[model samples]
Target: MTKTEQFSKLLREMEECGEDEQKQKIEEMKELINEMNTDDFRHVFTKEQFNKFEKMIEEKKISLENAALLLKHVGYCKKLKNIWIDGLKESLLNKRLELIIIAEDEKKKDEKNENLLIDLCECYISLSRGFPPELLSICVPHLLKKALMKGKNEEIQKEVEIVLLALSNIDHYGVNQALYLDEIKEIIQHHQEHHNLTQLAYQSAWLFLSYRLFFNDKSFKEVVANELHFVREAKRELVELTRQVDWMKKEENRGKKEEKELYIFFGWFSSIGNFLINCDLWNEEFAGLICSITRLLRVAKDNYRDIRRWFISILKTAAQKGAAKVDDLLKGGAVEAVLEEILQPAIDGMTEEDCFIFFLNISERLNEKEEDEKEEEERKAAKMEIFEKLEKEGYEDAIFSFHEKLPKAVFHPSFMFVPKNLSDYLMHL
Candidate 1:
């Protein structure tokens, strides 16, 4: 039977039984689920059906609604909401019910509920030990300070990791909407006090800078500008730690973990390049930051392409935003040398789709510049004018034939090269 049908059958069996029989049915269903070879469909239940099951589990009913809820909850259920609070009182709670609802709090960002789905899965760390475990080992005091400043749930390490990962992934605009400055500032302050947390502080500071640029806010420019020292410090630390990979593994030193070091390095370096360009701090520092980016790309051994893409993006963004400052970087031949030497090689090595995406990045930068120069109202009028002209030529021609010619002059200079074909086509039209 299908997973849902099996689940429905089990729910019917469980509900029809006495207390003793219910245990037997539950055991039998567990065995059945374990035995099922569902390699093609990893989920035992789909998301919608799982939610149905979650609601039914609470009501202890045997209906379509209950079976449906069971399916949804079982499919998507990662953690139970506020289960940590309950674990404090009842130590013998069922492991399955201990699931926390990983749904993003709509009130957290004042956005629509559907706009933010369950962004991450957080396995509950029991709170019965009196208070939430110290996250300092995983997250620095500065990170804790900032994550909690908005009264977010930093008590859970997985949740904090999710937020940090989110901060890294989301666009500048999204981060601004999601995170508060008060939280960011507090986190930076926390990092300032911690000696071993220089990397953490830099990443937080960099993210803050990125968030600022995304929103076009100048207030955090000073904070980002002042962080060049920390960026350098963090980079140095990363190099030192990575160099001692063997020693760290032998000593089992957690501080020298490769993943942590690479991310911290990336977080700070990308931030520095982004901040310098955004804050308009154009000079040797900006040049040095770009060079640092190039260096990272050279030494890149990480499996994650996102990290590499961001590194290149920082260069493109710096060039786009710091257009004024780039005259000097270009004059020294660094710009041409890097692109021809570094970026092109990377592009050539990438998959066809990746090459297309890289081209799109360049195209977007050019398009965005053009877009900024045009008046929004004028563009709308131009669009309407094109439609009107097309209507005069007949709506079908406008839609299929005339629209294709709009960008032919600019996009295809080769149109001039094919003079005979163009003449014949134009004559036919």
Candidate 2:
């Protein structure tokens, strides 16, 4: 018989063999492939035999060891390599090889065979691309462990990040049902403490949180709010990122290249704010988080314009919730920041529009504030304080400035002028 026919017959026999005999036949095949010339070995196995091998592996009739041996011998044949990788993935998806077992196997071979670890990680990533729910239970811990492993080679660390990102792409259902919340939080904390990995870590954390918010899962939300204290951690990260931006700016003044770190921080901060607003967990702590952001605003020199705009957008959303949230924004220094931004001579028109909208919302909340007999005096005093601050900050002048810039006969003709009365003017606008 020809080499191809002989290999085909052997494949049929292997399929019919019991486990022990199958192992022996696999060993025999491996030895045969090892002894054959590379060109001859490529010719010996027909496409049908390769397909049968893949099926056997996926069916759990072949051991991972034998699968790896098959992949190793496939070498640089792109078609065979792809087929082997698909078989490995099929095995994983079919649960023929449990994730923990794969992880353990990867750990054992990590030091001696780094390439295998990468290949395995790639398989996990492929599964994650489908946003498979199984990934949360099976793949996450292993990926996090690999990411957090001490003394991991740089290549391994990079592969771990790629896998983490792939896992982060899991859709809302996958995130809501995810079983490794604490472990994910640990990964976030680990990277938060590491100067270089903070961005990647935060990116991963945001990915998970965004999906949770999308699904509106209360239990998972509580995990982030109470256990992870996501707002607090995000605040800490923002502080670090702000300082880094300042350092970068100074370096630029000294003739170094300008860095885009500030933009990156802004993107993350905006994402956090947007996610938090949708979570419906706004409370005193959430207010305090906004207050902390205002404090950051005070210290920010570069990119303050964009920062103020994005932050005020968040404040506006918070204010719309109720009087209490508006009070939170006022107490958080949001009013002062809005006034400051509105008063800027060169502020963009869109930004001024946003600030004006926020001002109107806050004013409406203040008007609707209930008068409790016991707290009447305190409430009046607080309102008086806010009024005084607005007046002192040129609230009228800012309004006039904005009014003067409006086009004549616009679609919203009411917006063309600032009314004489503050409340009436806001109501009209």
Candidate 3:
């Protein structure tokens, strides 16, 4: 018999049982649920039956509604593991969609049976927990769309929260931003001012929204800028990052879970920095962003070079792309954040290449000859202050190491044969 058919048979056996024997039948059913949970299908099915099960999923012959009714009995879904999940890759993706269809069908029935619908959603959670990141494509839009639709109904908000958790699994394997950016953005916009939506729900939608921003696709830059109204969202996320960074910096909060979450957010936040630079979307309204992000450098351990690289990229973009003025950046403690906090902590190798590039941008701005005599003197003082700090700190060593190459980098003739390494040095510096 098929898994569901076997389950169906067990249900029949339970129905036919006398009241005195009901408990025994129920134990048998629990055994079946365990029987269905296995490292390989063979644990539950004969080899021939297992191959047929795979074929049914691939051929669209499985009834997911009934499948959910079966899997829900296995109970709570947490972060599932690897191994068999990957082994079942091809059909497993189809199986996941089948489960979604069942969940949506249950929602449509709206039978007012909260428990039943919730149990069905658990089936999705159990399966989705082990899903590979790339396989997220087919299910995320549906989940977000369901959350957006169901969030409007206050009575069903609990179920909607559970749905959001399913989407939040993107933390394990991030979604491909290009695939569902628009839909995710719409969900975020919907949640921003929603009345009955819980804070948890709203935050989850924004989380949904951020996964889409965590990638580089030249095509989506304009979409992010225009459609997503990214500037507003960028400031909003900065506020959140400020809170999170502050909370994360506390010594008491240094538990393993917090550390794991911190690194995960760092990876996503790193990509956000990339968007700021690659999208060319920076402007003056983002001045406070530098302050908030620079503060995050305080907690970013210097040995984590790539995260530091991404954070510096944001500062570099802010300095170069006009979102933040050089004077404002200097005044906002950017100089100290870059030099003492990030560079000095990084004792092993050169993490300050971008720092120099950032300083070069600042130097050029400070070099601009002021029309006012008093302003000229103030500008010279700022320049001198930065130069002194760089020398006092070891950034001067980086500068002195660049030596003649620094001049050529600053004033490379367009026609000169800038070697690949030289081009890379200038790019990084």
> lDDT: which candidate is best?
2
Q: What is the TM-score of candidate 2? A: 0.56
Q: Tell me the TM-score of model 3.
A: 0.50
Deviation (Å) of 209 in candidate 2: 2.1
Off by over 4 Å in 3: 1-141, 149-186, 194-229, 236-264, 267-271, 299-310, 316-332, 342-394, 398-429
Return the candidate ranking by TM-score, descending: 2, 3, 1
In model 2, where is the ten-residue run with the lowest total lDDT?
76-85
For all predictions, the C-alpha RMSD in Å is 15.9, 13.5, 10.1
**TM-score against truth, every candidate:** 0.41, 0.56, 0.50
Candidate ordering by lDDT (highest first): 2, 3, 1
Once model 1 is optimally superposed onto the true structure by TM-score, how far is the C-alpha of residue 96 displaced, in angstroms?
18
Model 3 deviation from the true structure expressed as Cα RMSD, one decimal place: 10.1
lDDT per residue (tens digit) for residues 1-429 in model 2? 655566567667876777678777767666555444435554654444445655777687765565544443343122211222333333433353345335555464435444444444434453323435544554555555655543345664544545454445454555444456666767665655663353543555456556666665677677666666666666666666666655324432522112235434554564575565656565446556677777766665244555656666666656564323555676778878777777667777666666766666655555654667646555555567677776674676776565566443433323445464544565332
Q: Write the per-residue lDDT of candidate 3 for residues 1-429, one digit (tens) a residue.
A: 766577557655544455446556556655655444344333433333334434444554544344344444332222211112322223444364455445555464445444444444455544434655434554565565566564466667755665664555454355666556666666656655555455445445545454555464645666666565555655566566546544534545444444434444453464455455456654544546566667666656533444556677677655664435565577657777777643353332234456556665665567578899987887777777766666564655445454333444433222144444432333232
- Per-residue lDDT of 287 in model 2: 57
lDDT of candidate 3?
A: 0.52
Better candidate number, 2 or 3, judged by TM-score:
2
Model 1: C-alpha RMSD to truth? 15.9
Stretches of candidate 2 exceeding 4 Å from the true structure:
1-174, 189-199, 247-260, 282-288, 298-305, 322-324, 370-381, 400-429
Query: What tens digits encode model 1's per-residue C-alpha lDDT throughout 264-382?
Result: 55665555555546566434444454555555554442343444565555554554444323433333333333333232333423222222222223223333323544444443443
Please give the lDDT score for candidate 2. 0.55
